[model samples]
Target chain A: MSSGKIVELRQVLAERFPREIPPPASLLTTGIECLDRSLEGGMRRGTITQLVAPYPSCGSASLLHDLIDSMHTSASQFVALIDGKNSFEPLGNTDLLLWIRCENANQAVRATDLIIRDGNIILSILDLKQNEVQELRKVPLTAWYRLQRVAADSGTTLLLITSHYISGSCFAAVQINNPLRINDLAELSYTVSQTRLLDFIYRKNYAELGYAQA
Target chain B: MPKPSLFAVIYTPYYRLQCAQQKRLRTESNQQADLPFADRQTELSDQYSQSYSSNSNSITHQTIPPVTVYIREDIASALLEDSQIIEINPTAEAAGVKIGITPSLAVARAPELQLYAPEVELERQQQQALLQLCYRYSPFIESTGPGVCTLDLRGRRNKNQEIWARDLLSRWRSLGFAANVGIGPNAELAAQAAKFANPYLEVVENSQLLRSLPLESLQPSAYLLEILHNWGIRTLGALIQLPREDIGQRLGLEGLSLWDRAAGRSAKVLHHLQPPEIFKETIDLEQRLETLEPLLFILRRSLEHLVLRVESVYRLVAEIKLQLHLDSGDKLERSLPIPAPTQDITILFRVLSQYLETVQTAAPVVGFTLEVFASDPAKHQFDLFYSRLKDPNRFFQTLARLAALVGNNRAGIPERLASYKPDNIRLRLPAFDWKSNSSISAESDQPRIGPALRRYRPPIPATVELADGKPICIHSNLIKGHIDKQRGPWRTSGNWWDPDGWEIQEWDIQVTDRGIYRLTFSAGNWAISGVYD
Candidate 1:
């Protein structure tokens, strides 16, 4: 076939069987330029974003601190932290933070559901980095989907802090691999804010693209 | 220009009879006299004797006793007192009983009569109730007489005054009183209209309606009434027809004053009053409330009535005091605080039902008194862009439900306790004025650092193997694995003077398969304190 005819045919095919273009994700700025730039523009609103840090004492804790600090300083919004394993040690003024200290993954999940349904807090961080894998495994996949639905409905930004990937329904998963280097607390905070985390977006057309001819 | 003044008079025809009947019903069930009937009789009889002896007029003069007996139902009856019949019910009147006649003579005339002694206290209470009910319509109210109240409706705009009058009378009827409401320009005219009006009447032109009423409806002295009767001036119109000068020349100032009133020209100043602020209603249930549904039904009805009263005054209900009288002679009392003062009946009913659901009564409820404390309506202006609670009342109600589901002390905003003890916290209800801006502090002094801890309610017991004074392995119901890495055994102790003093060593350990865990070595026992999720 001629190139012009092929182009027209392609255009007709595209219109008849349209590609599913997801709506543009609304972003809620983390107030850190580096993080926002790395994730296109901060975190996606109304979706779960997982921050996985496999090793102990990785800069994930510091990253969480910076996210909370940025939200507090920039938007003056309240952040709810549903601590799964009771390991997070809050430092400094936590006036804008609601700390729901849960004993295990189940309690943390329940707390997260309650806060998400309440729809009062702007950002909810479900930190399960210190919870045992066995305990986290008990949290049904349905629970994660429910959380995702609730977060979307409420337009709340849910940041899941875990040691491994748990939520299949997450919009994107970012891994914090940089270890704790700076000893000074102030320098460590600044360094954590600049560190580039790996971002993995879960696409809907992956299976379709795999079946298509290259 | 002065506002056109309108007055409404609510008159209960058989106030004493209704009060006595109510008292009898109330006592019949309890088998106890809240106020002794015999003592009331003696008091009434003594007052009658004094008034009778003091008035040394002709025998034709009629003296009204403070207490009057009337036949309410058809039953065997006898004269409880030799005193004259001051008041008689329709049944007694039909049986040939007349005022000023002795009770014995009336009983002889008709053998079947059911006489009920007057409950003076109950009548006074009912009169006060009438005043309170009328006060809801107009602020200027006066207790004109027993079960009679005059309300000034001046400056009050109503498209249909007759409908308002009928509604007032209907409310009174629901309270067990056959009341009539009348509207006029003055208190005297309104009262006269009320006495003659069939259930409800309004006097647009006072002279027109006032002319047909009997002179006795004005409640003039017996001597004046007798003089008017002698002159054949039976109706107010006939009395008003006579020349004012002639009446003054013939019967002096009293006659002129009476003529003025008959002419609807009496400038009677009403005793304007401030209604009582107490919004309480006590209801004696006919049947004991054995279930929550019935109790809630009664409570909702009472709350609706009270809310109507509150709304008339442009106020909202802030709190409710519920006192349930149990059949066992014990009382259960609860005061429910409204998180947001509201005038919505549905919201108030929800609040009341939520409270009643949690109530565990020792005995069935025999009676209840519900008093709603009203407050001035609140005014607020929210920011244009700021987020607010979708429904504050619903949120509070949901909080209550959640509390009931979990526990009283479990749900709410968590507040940290001021102590050295680890995991010291308490839950407190959110403030009524919960502004989003108030949640975050304006001052950014403390540098935010580290992740927040997720505390286990009670630390799980765990076995720990130490290598060189450091935890190397950990096993518990939640986590079982070797410690991959470990942090310090931070020692802390406090409250040494008290018996609850504590000393502990806390360690942050990262298990191999499990996540990071906080281990505490206290009193020779090791336990997993929390997870850093």
Candidate 2:
């Protein structure tokens, strides 16, 4: 195809699909240089982001701890951690954290719904990393979509931490593959800050690229 | 010079009788009086007579129109004191029953007579209700006497005081009280206006209007009235016309005081009052409250009224005490603590409705008393960047809904229990002033490492092959494989003094297929207790 015809086709596609360009100031900083730069500042507000770590010791929990600590220290915002299967253990300042420990994935999802509807906390993390696959499977697809809607309405950043990709409604998804062995707490935290995750290509990127071509 | 302060006095005539009628309406409609409903007037009269005769000792039959009603009916009636007729109704007056006459003699003169003793408690409650109602109009109010309230309208500028007075009187009349309102430059003048003014309101610039009022309106001692009658001073105008120095010399302080009052020069210092802080209202439901909607409606109305009153005093409602009087004669009282002291009607209503929706009354609601406790508005210094909940009341309401949906103990902040047992924690409701602070530093002294374990509530039962007290393999629904790496059993037990004591042997093992699992052997059963994240 000729370049002019390609450009015309791109223009038509761009007109059909639009992508949200959040204000630079509205994005919440993760306090990690590479992560923030890759996501163009940090997580988008009023959207859900998923961190998928299929293997053990993939640094997802460390990332959660870092994000919570950063939010507490920098933004002075409250963080709610809905721990599915009652797994999450606090590693840093818990004064700003409201930990809701649930018995199963169902309970955690319900807790997330309540917290998002309350619209109180700035960040809500639903940690389902240790939930059994059978228990997690019990959650309906509509529950995740409902959570996304509530997150948008409440203007809260919902970060879903799980062992595998569970929903297609996430605004952004990143897979943790970096592996590191550490003997001390300091080394573990440093490794966590240094580890890089692969971000899955979102549909928004394709729309943006189409718009740029047009 | 400061302008003379204006005052308005609300005087409810026959306050005790009105209170007795109110009590009868409140307590007797559903219980006693078999009068036909179609005859509403006679039904009300019968209810009043029945209640009045039951509470009073002077009357034995439920046929007489209580003393005040007899007076209104133009029938002979007298109020007895110490076996003498202290006051005679107008009908009795026309029938030759005079004050200070023996009751038997007064009865002889007026062959058909009715008498009623005073109800002190009922009168006191009615007075309080009057004070509470008038306090809404003006903050500086005083319960001058039984059924009398003096309101200071100093800074209030209604174009016509008569219209304001009439509106007040109408409100009192709606409550089944015959009230008269009068406005003047001073309290004494306002009271005098209420007594003798033709239209119930008399705003006098001088003592000119006081001329026609009888000396009896002043309510002087009988000796003073007798003395005034003998002196041919029957009117306030005539009394004021007398020389003040001569009256003081002749009649002493009593005569001088009366002279000053009639002349509108009385310097009586009014006890400026602070309206009582109590904000409560009770109403008998016309129909049974079988559902939550009607009860909520009434509660919202009462809450709005109380919120307005609390706002008038620059305060906020901190708590609500709801008392439901059920048809079963049982009282259900619930005290709802406000998450945040607020004047918002919607928030207060939500708090009340949330409670009422869950409350299971023993019987149909017949009456209710709602009392809201007031507090000074809470002052919060919010953080510069961190925001608390945008609306705390809304958050609390959502919390309540969530608690209702899930069990109450299931949803809230998790607090770890101080025990050696694994997975020990409890949920707690958030405080009102929950806010985030960036200055809070982490407890870095004890930094934990390794992935947190996810506990399986009621661990899955498993079959394990043992070799020298070590698990060689495990078979379970979630994990079915040979154990690759294994740890020895760790034993823990607690509560030996109680029959519900527990002893458990736990082991950390990695299955070939399942990544890692915590196996527990308790009561001769091996189960997969949890999984390592």
Candidate 3:
């Protein structure tokens, strides 16, 4: 069949059976008030969500640790962290976190792909925040799309933590605009607790966009 | 009378020869697998070069025909000595080699004939495989002979007898043994039917089918056979025409039994025995396995067969035991326990492969045996609040692959070691059952301490200038900047009595505008320890 005919047939079917269309998927709430509120209840499942940390001392790493901690304590779900730079420090309880420490951006991305495809982990965080920008730039865009498709198929939540926005197929992107200060070191937990995350871009009809690209 | 007890016999023709050929094929495949990629490539290239060079000399390709082979009855004798050939393959028969012929005469008939001694161990293993497959059909089974198994289908529903028999025969074929099934009213009749069966046969009317047979079919005594021959009685129908009481009184008990057998009336009871539950397969390699590829290939094949056996018995493998015979006369034995009792091949392979990846043997392996312990499936009830792994086997397999990609110590659940030393942490293997936890409540609820430090492994050495016991300038591979703010000179020490004692002073400083970093002075050297993130 030609592409035009297929599209027409799909349109006719959709119009004929409007009520049969599925409702939007429920979000996966991490139980973090700030994050859940910013993401409008929680992160979307089966899609990539980019969390950009533009500055070095931003609370992205802290947020990751707390996010994992909260997920474990509240929901009792497992979280997988693909550490790009092998820099995460285990200060708190990490009984539910499966940390795969990699040396570079390429290794981290591959690890993320494996974890997502396994489907055992509900939320997978690919932390490329500390990796070199040049190395992150070398990651092909097609790799991101492949990851998105796998996540969609597996019904997994893939959160990409980066210094700059790299995934064009992400369902949404959130930025941590606040940078840590020396005084904030006195009460680090309090500072992280006060973390303010801003939503930058959210594709409400992300599935249509993904289909278009595909 | 109730229906006569049906009997099914699974027969493998030329069983010893089949076992030898199967083993030879396996060994050849293992040798191919053992060859490294470069060596295999070189071999291929050599073959190609030889073929290309030979093409110019001949318009037609010349090939060496395979030599006809037969198994000798008395394997203890030397090949040159005169020996009787017991089992002959089709190739040998096609070349005019006949059974019961002397080796010398057979060689003269088929000059390319190759005689092989029987392998008792290989035949035993093949027989066990046949019995294991037969056990799937009926419980009252007998090890009737070398290549035959008789199953008593007394209470079994005979509606789908042909279907299950075909399935059983196919399973036997998968183990590299071509077999046939015959169902009859008696064991002897079943065995006879199996020999002539086209893969499967069933005796419907025993008297009608048995009457046409010659007296030799019952293997009567030579004296009795000669008398019957003189009496002009060649077939069972003719012999049974005589009165049974008169024949018994005249010919004796042996004659009476022979007449009964010829009439398809078998009074012999079956000596039933349980099929051995032990699941193990061993191979003696022709070449010592110095690399892992061939060993893994052998193991994967063996494990697959063992799993099939376990499945046939309606059980799960609880543990896998691997024993390797090394050239140095030492055996390496290891048992790997499965987290979940499962028959998944991928998961079991991962468990074995992971162990092999880390093992360092003192000598090349000459042979190996793989065994699996079977168990009933486990039952577990989980808490309502927590979620468990959807597929534990697949999850563990993925974990093994991840461990291969990353270092073993790098991928797992991170546990903080109990010590004052900084960055003291170890990875714990993840559990199959995951529980929802709130163990972090104490730490999370505790007054906020500070941001988590992203520590650099093997803290980078740095050149520092200090004034008034405070760091003023810092230069390292990570950061080179003037200290905009400095906070700590916290002193700590541990293990003072031991030679591995250490003392350190740490300072949390802001690198001008770069970031807040942790600087440490230990053993009279300044280093950038970590960055606060």
DockQ score of each predicted structure, in the order shown? 0.11, 0.19, 0.43
Q: What Cα-based lDDT does every candidate model obtain?
A: 0.69, 0.71, 0.77
Which CAPRI quality tier does the interface of model 2 achieve? incorrect
The residue pairs in collision within model 2 are none
Top DockQ prediction, candidate number: 3
State the lDDT of candidate 2 residue by residue for B9-92, as single tens digits.
888665654554444444332322322332534544465455435544321222322111111334566666678776555577
User: What is the fnat score of candidate 2?
Assistant: 0.30
Q: Tens digits of per-residue lDDT for model 3 on B331-424? A: 9999988877876667788889988987889999998888999888777787797878888877877887888888678789887776788887
lDDT string for model 2 (A90-153, tens) is 5546666777767779988988898898887778899998787888889999999899889878
Ranking by DockQ: 3, 2, 1
Docking class of 3: acceptable
Q: What DockQ would candidate 2 receive versus the native complex?
A: 0.19
CAPRI accuracy category, model 1: incorrect
Model 1 scores what on Cα lDDT?
A: 0.69
Second chain TM-score for model 2:
0.67
Candidate 3, residue B138: Cα displacement in angstroms equals 2.9
CA shift at A145, candidate 3, in angstroms?
Answer: 4.7
